[model samples]
Target: MSSLLLRHHRPFLAFWFARVFTASGFQMITVAIGWQMYALTGNVLDLGLVGLIEFMPKILFILITGHVADRFDRRKVAALCQGAQGLIALGLLLGSGAGGISREMIFVIAFLLGTARAFEMPTTQALLPNIVPSNLFPAAVAASASAMQAATIVAPALGGLLYALGTHWVYGPAVVLYSCALSLMLSLPARQLPLKQKVSLESLLAGFRFIRSRPAVFGAISMDMCAVLLSGATALLPVFAKDILLTGPWGLGLLRSAPAVGALLMSLWLTRFPIERRVGPVLFTSVAIFGVATIGFGLSTSLWFSLAALVLLGAADMISMVIRSAFVQLQTPDEMRGRVGAVNGLFIGASNQLGDFRAGVSAAWFGTVPAVMIGGVGALVVTGLWIRLFPELAKRDHMHPQPNPQPPSAAA
Candidate 1:
């Protein structure tokens, strides 16, 4: 452990462990969901609908959720959300044990899970700055990202293995893990913020207005949204696992873990040697590499080749993610963290869910390979377009927070 992580940051360490348990369980559930749904329907579009069902509540309730995080105790809110997710997992366990799990039941559960995530993500993100010193915040973000990648790397394999035993096995451990996460979240030191005196439409929309006013923040987030929205391939992993690569559930597990494996490596590297110069160009270059790697994965028939491509894809994305996360959180004021995080969460939710929908529809219309390949091309093109559209983002030279160059009035 880095001395930075171990010393003077016991609360942050607890938070990181909470992330591990929560993220591990979530990733495990993801594998179970994708495999079970595909097995039940064997339809690509159905897989896409999985993401859509989960995304709906997130999109609809995001703004309110952000306000709730800001107005209330973020730790308590996160604990409640984590507890709800645990109950949902328990529901899945019971359903699987009864052998009564249906496609509709799965979709309903996914929606409930998405609702929990909607409240949890923004609150959890906003809570970090309160947990660590400002000088160490960037390092904390890197460590946090690394921790998440570690969970991603481990959880899928565990999920796949347990799923191979039985569906109930997957949810059982998930329920336990989520319970642990809730406990850890509750143990974190409470953060006290001034309560909002009044609630109004304008207050709810402050995060939106703030993000819109910050060009660098807006550009980074927009670029990420477009690139990932176009090239998200995780939702379609089952298609590749069973049909394209002819690998079984275990292969699916390895495939899912490969990207995170690369990401974990990159995150650790960043913690040791942070990106200090040409931050904007690094972001753009990393995204472009992500596009090319996606194309490579789309074209590969061999499992090894696909895994290699995915590793590159994940490594590139980690760079982009670290930079973007640090930029958004470091720049935003403490009171506005929840709202800003909500906006960031919305972009992420859109890219992930809508991206899956696009891939499913495209796979249905053209073909899997063509759909993925075309999306990769779109990602590359978006990278170029974003460079042109957000010149200030490209000109940005460092990750440290900078004074706003333009007045709030200049926002359109």
Candidate 2:
């Protein structure tokens, strides 16, 4: 296995490590931002705003970002995005060191960072299938996911620890990591650009049309968007850590890392033993478990209990993600990958950032615990409704369907 991976997957290995650096840096920056903002304002709504600001670019530029990835050099686009993020982190470092950082400044920087990510997410997603052979794509997804989850598991914890000294400590390291990621992005082999086509309104909306036409794909993607949109509670962790759990930055760090720990382990498992049957059932069931875990986390007062619940939540969500990612990529043709990935990225951004907004606003209105508990319940409700609304999702028997056999043409 080692020999095969080394010989056939060297580019994947480079991509793998690149993800580690990039995701790790991004996660650390996120932790510092959440902690610093909450400390400065003592307001939960501010946290939600950060997510909304970051997510706004996705909505505003979804059409254009997708087109850029589809038309331009994907590696160059990814490298540019990473460089922008590095600059943003460096700015934060300088501001924090000078004791000049404020809530407004954070929000502004978040918007800039979001714009970079809006382009980065789809371009990077579209890059993978091009590098790895189709037969090996599922394994590559699992391997790549494991790398990402591993970075996620450690970075927030490290960020939390570094925050004890100063925000600059966190931001400083994040800038360096982003630089490393940028270098790696440049190292990746270039993908063949999609064939030239007419630029029009129809092209911009193509991704939306493609997703809607496929029932199972639509079901899987929409289910993720709705379920996570409700179940997300990470935005409120600072509140929980300070008020309910009565722990400092270290405990908050552990709380943040718990989910990624679960996710990393699950990714590793998937790499060795890919899902073979009942793909739809597995996807729905895992999401249901995710909801259950979220409720558990919200209701727990003990830090250990909360961490455990989060771990379970992460594991369940990871299972659903691997299935959705592999299925979507396999079904998409190379020419359409960037656009499709863009729409997928939008759903992901909505489920995550908008979900944060939901959690934040709800926490402000209903109090933290009740808001989270209600969201978890809402996730369960959404899952049930999705099963009914998209029965084709429930009927799916494999991780991905076998390609339809094409008939012989006159040329053949």
Candidate 3:
């Protein structure tokens, strides 16, 4: 532990630790929600609906959150959001305990949670560069991703155990975890970026225009958006586990986590040997592999086979994650990091939620196997088209430093 701290800032380390715990506790809530809803309703569509509700508010508010992160003291913003999330969880616990928890209430709670996440995520992303030097950004992103997936690997299983005990019980630990996250977030030095101008709708539009101007950033973000939106396999896991795989809730936990296990391994490797060049090709190939793996998972009947497929899918997904995040963070100017990160939250974060909705609706209408398999093939096709459309992304061979933060020309 001491040796690892030698390599990074203490604040960054605390941030990562907080994320691991928060993510794990959050996973518990995720697993508990899915398991509890399914147990009560026994409908796969209901499972998908939960994710849909959870992400909708996030999709709506994330850009504003990103703009806010760019404009203010980020640590305070993070603390406030985490505190909101913790309180929300506590409210959920009480509602569930009342024996009158309806589906509408759950959806409302999910939307509230998403609203909290909209602010929390961009702040977290923007805070990274401030904590670590620019060059260490790649390693830090990879490490942070690994830590997140690592939490995913453990939390779902623990969540399964807690669900087995009782649904209401899961929130208890979650509140504790969120409290810890709040404490860590508060502990960070109050840091704010030197702003070029006050934020406005015009400035927000400029950020979108900036992304449009950069082919690499556009390509990377687009590829990620399409891949997740098309091939959202996790949203279909309840059906896969219960109907296709013939495993119980335990199986659901394992199936959901299989990809994260692979993601964890891949993230570790990326930390050791970061992607240096030809990132476009790396991202394209990774999405292709993700497609193939998702298709294979859709076809598999055996539990272990499906798990293996998801693991492969996860591994491929990690390649995309590292390259895209690195491209976004490394290429963007610091002054625009929060807003750019928020725009990223839009495609990356919103696409994920939208994908969940897509998966849920498609699985409900078309049946599970075809939904996943078709989505996988669509991902494959989209990747091919994107490669041709964004030649700069494919041809770029080197990264360059952005213009440094310049001092004001003169005092007013």
Candidate that beats the other on lDDT, 2 or 3, i.e. the better one: 2
Report, for every candidate in turn, its global Cα lDDT versus the true structure.
0.89, 0.89, 0.80
Quick one: ranking by lDDT, best first?
1, 2, 3
Candidate 1 lDDT over 1-412, as tens digits, reads 4676678889999999999999998988989988999999999988888888888887899779888888899989999999999998899889888888889998998899999999999999999888888788877887888899999999998899889999888999999999999998888987657555478888888889998988888898889889989998888899999999998888899999999999999999988898999999999999999999999999999999999999999999989888888778777888888888888999989888888988888888888999899989999999999999999898889787567797567656
TM-score for candidate 1: 0.96
Q: Can you tell me which runs of candidate 3 are displaced by over 4 Å?
A: 1-8, 399-412
In model 2, where do residues sit more than 4 Å from their true spots? 1-3, 402-412
In the range 109-212, model 2's lDDT, one tens digit per residue, is 88999999999999999898878887777667777788888889999999999999888889998889888888888887875656487779998889999999
Best by lDDT: 1
TM-score (C-alpha) between model 3 and the true structure: 0.92
Error of 1 at 147 (Å): 0.5
**Where does candidate 3 clash, by residue pair?**
none
* Tens-place lDDT digits, model 3, residues 34-134: 76677678776887778788777655775577678888888888878888888977887887788766777777777887888778787888887887776
